[model samples]
Target: MVTWLGAPSVAALREALHEVAPQLGGGAIVPRNLVPDAAPEWSAATAVLAGRYVVKFAWAEPAALRIRHQVRVLGALKVSAPWLALPAVVVASESPALLVTELAAAVPFFDVRHLVGAGGRARVAQDLGAVLARLHDPDVLAAVSAAAGPLAAPVMPAATDALRRGPAAPAPDARWERVAAWCDWTDRVLGPAPGRSGLVHGDFHGGNHLWDERSLRLELVVDWETAGPAEPEYDLRCLPGDCGMELFGAVVDAYERVSGAALDRDRIMGWHVRTVLDDVLWRVEAGVPMPDRRTAGEWVDDLGARLAGFGVGG
Candidate 1:
């Protein structure tokens, strides 16, 4: 009985969680944390249950694409052996677009961009890697494709059409400098396109992964809404590419190990840098502001640096 509505309003969480976990009593339902740092993408508020569960929801686009992607991913898991130690979906209401998945007795992995730490990091890396590998298996891919192939929200009609023309719009930046300033390894690494065959998680990174709470082990890699068929290297492009190399390295290494197939080293490399510019560009377009409206200059510099690194002097 919660009718979910706009995020950012404190009352929303109260009313929503009360609806989800009525037993806790209305007064006890309170969000543990609120993050205003995240812009148009998402804003979150968490409410911890009495030694039982944690309830959270995005004030951005909750019951829409989130539900769709989750449902789609869950549907795939039915046929695929992901062996994901994920929380069970307790009760999901499609009308208000609220999903009350069991909170893992776990914490979000803590690695730099990952959700885990040193010891926890390795375990999560291995476990998540294993799950992803199975999810990518040929049979699973085929089955998933048939069940629900790469899907973007029906609202974003051009998502698929845009990919064929080349990833949506290279990270919101015009210069693409984020990658260039990072390192020499980037240019040599991001070469030609890798073969595109399997389904991609699309937005693969730490902000979304969580460790299982009960055993303190990493659970299923949640947040699969932006999934779809695309070049295999597509997911790797989202990393921050500054000093987060070690984190990204762990993810890629673990992933290749479980998949039993060498990821195109070059392609993954390109993703490292490309995503930076792409993100910047997206932010500008989405009306997210840079501290001083200097995004244009920033982008040009970023691109220049990248070209210089790649030896593309022009």
Candidate 2:
């Protein structure tokens, strides 16, 4: 579920949905044209409706299994959040590899960048971190997973193979070699810190988060295509890796303040490396130009340096 709906012939997907939902019969479903206010970087859909609920359906290959798993996880989180703005997944169908979630009235975290200089950034940071920390709590972990059902054993080497063989842009032979070596190193180091792993949101980049600029309120974290159990640090790395430490320092500090748990220096750097490699692999596999890799690499290197500065090494 890490990769997203490319120019997937939505025709196949739409056909699948129409068959399963069947409510689209005869005439038009008005929400068919209803796109969300903000678009997620990694998904193809905008909105759908079954009954009165508004849903956003994200498509993915090999998503049949992951979507099944996510419906349960989000269902539990729906209960866990209680009063907060959280999405309750309504349907997941393998025919189109879709997960339908209740749509919320928030903007993408990136879309609200205009408010970053305002007081809202800090509060958003606090809320984001607190949410992750709260979800990371051991009790929360057991409850979420027990409700989600059994987790698939994460296969680092297979994933590494997918990386080398999948969508990231092709580097010079030299860079590819370096990336391959780093993958091996990551498997050895980062893979082990997956202790007490629960449902990890594999992708938590700003593009996936929704927030209210005026109130600094976090809305639905829309993309669960990558949601499931893994390492806690892996999820922690999600924020720092994508948003840059300057933006995420507030989040980390806020989470630490409330959780009273220190971030593991070892796992932080290790997972940071994993995130960097993942971006690289994604660009390469997608057959995008290599220059895009250089640009993304600069950002990731900056992120790596920041992670190391967080006292994370190895």
TM-score of 2: 0.69
**Candidate 1 accuracy as lDDT:** 0.54
lDDT of 2 by residue, 12-92 (tens): 445655665655323222345333332343334544443444443444544344555556666777776554446665565
Residue 277 alpha-carbon offset, candidate 1, angstroms: 2.8
RMSD per candidate (Å) reads 7.1, 6.5
TM-score of each: 0.61, 0.69
TM-score of 1: 0.61
Model 1 per-residue lDDT tens digits across residues 1-314: 22334765557765665665565435444466576556544554556545455554656654344654666666666566446544576655544445556566444544333334566656645665566555556666677767766554222122212222322434433333333343344445644444646666766665566655545455556666576666666665543243144555676688888777777645665555455444454555566665336664475465455445544453
Task: Give the poorly placed runs of model 2, Cα more than 4 Å off.
Answer: 1-19, 24-61, 80-84, 88-98, 153-195, 289-297, 304-314
Score candidate 2 by lDDT.
Answer: 0.58
lDDT of 2 at 215: 75
